[model samples]
Target: MRLNIHTLIHPTIQKLAYEIIYQKSHKKLQNTDNEKTLGMLIFYEILRKWLKIDNIYIKKVDVLKERRLSNQLDKYLIITNIIECYNILADVQRILPEPYLKHIDFNNINNSFYCNEKLQEYRIIIFEKFLKNYGIIEIINYLQKNNQINLNHVKIICLTCNSNILKYLANKYPQLNIYTIKIN
Candidate 1:
């Protein structure tokens, strides 16, 4: 139940951010006035630096293939700045079940925090692709396995084009929020 800045962020991410921002590299961040806002920026920049430095990222770097990641990174940067809030998602992004949290926007993540149409659309793209690669069983397993809590506590996001799956999950867990592309 640790809840501090250091505990909230992973050591690797902290090191990457620190080294890139202050220690090894002399890169200037987008916002220097507020350190908290730098969390997401640094995470994205780590991806940038890895793309240039890491052997795997370098070899596997495909601009077209990583379009989904790039798209979310854009929204991540946008929402991080506009919302002025950073919590579990920033930490979870760098440290997660597999650090594959590209779909759920960190900003609008809350139990009662209804996602907007555009955000839902963005997530559907991510979820659909994920479902294609790894079937529903795997997706649910991953979602069910995650135990990290955001600032607003935490909740599992179930998205499906199948109304049957939605209904099944809803009836199974009434309190949980199961989202469709059309839901507000």
Candidate 2:
């Protein structure tokens, strides 16, 4: 899927996923069956709360069957449950988008700067872990390192605990496009 910063879920759901991951880590749960069960519970609870429904539940087998059917029909499986969500997010440690230099040619310039640049229009730096002091250093470091690139085209993707600090950051770095993604 062509997911941007908007693909992230709500903050409450993100916190719940973090809690699930923390529990799984402490218990050393290695079985996918159990993981799926736990994931289902969270997913069901979120849906129930959001929809304002009571005691809504779905079987793991049914979910899997629907996923397969969706795949057969050439449709995207929207919800892969919380564990899959966490796994997908955890794997992506960093995403430094390519800089769209108006005049610079790639033939002479060093390509070491962005070996994994997927999107070229905007530079996106992702942080799966908690931000250091609300990501002030990271933002500054990115701007400094990519001083050759224009700040207006950059998109800083991070997970921050504080929304107020995020607002502050948005104001502080008006040149860059800062996006806070919530973990699902």
Candidate 3:
């Protein structure tokens, strides 16, 4: 069962939607700095593209409109930023079993990070969707901020689609644990 990002009813998407709702209701997360709107737009845009009924659903919605609409599904949505989006993906990847991961197109998604507390390790996962030029810069910035993480315990995982950036990072930081996964 290959995971399709465009399909609303796909297991992966269903899981994502359920997680969003659960997180929203349980945590009472509110939108901040327009990030949530942008995230929601990006998310739904991907989900809406393949749906035949998408044409009939509300075409455009602003923050106020979205707030006012407050339909059942809308009420449960957990609005988030890019980092949160990455965190959500990491959570899903961690929660789902290995077999499910193989079928999901993780490479197509943007940047995300995962921390394995059991191993005391951190993984910075970069994808093709990330900005090619600034990807290394962003990672460097994150590393600088989170300096507590020992360099030995930090792993940089890059999709083969960003091989150039991976090569540069690996060469520049020889001590860093860098690995690449080729996605077809």
Candidate 1, 82-176: lDDT as tens digits: 22223323453442223323343332344322223343222121122001122333333333344221212112221113445445545543433
Winner by lDDT between candidate 2 and candidate 1? 2
Weakest 10 consecutive residues, lDDT, candidate 1? 123-132
Highest-TM-score candidate: 2
**Ten-residue segment with the worst summed lDDT in candidate 2?**
70-79
Q: Tell me the whole-model lDDT of each prediction, alpha carbons only.
A: 0.30, 0.37, 0.34
Q: Model 1, residue 105: what's the lDDT?
A: 33
lDDT of 2 by residue, 19-115 (tens): 5557655876544443344344433332232122124344685473222111121111121122224543322212111112222121232332332
Model 1 TM-score relative to the real fold: 0.23
| Stretches of candidate 1 exceeding 4 Å from the true structure | 1-126, 129-134, 146-160, 182-184
Candidate 3, superposed: residue stretches over 4 Å from native: 1-131, 145-148
Scanning candidate 3 in windows of ten residues, the lowest lDDT window is: 70-79
Residue 53 of model 2 has an lDDT of 16
Best by lDDT: 2
In model 2, which runs have C-alpha deviations exceeding 4 angstroms?
Answer: 1-7, 10-122, 132-135, 141-146, 181-184
The clash numbers for all candidates, in the given order, read 0, 0, 0
Model 2: clashing residue pairs?
Answer: none
In angstroms, how far off is 126's CA in candidate 2? 3.4
Once model 3 is optimally superposed onto the true structure by TM-score, how far is the C-alpha of residue 165 displaced, in angstroms?
1.7
The order of the candidates by lDDT, greatest first, is 2, 3, 1
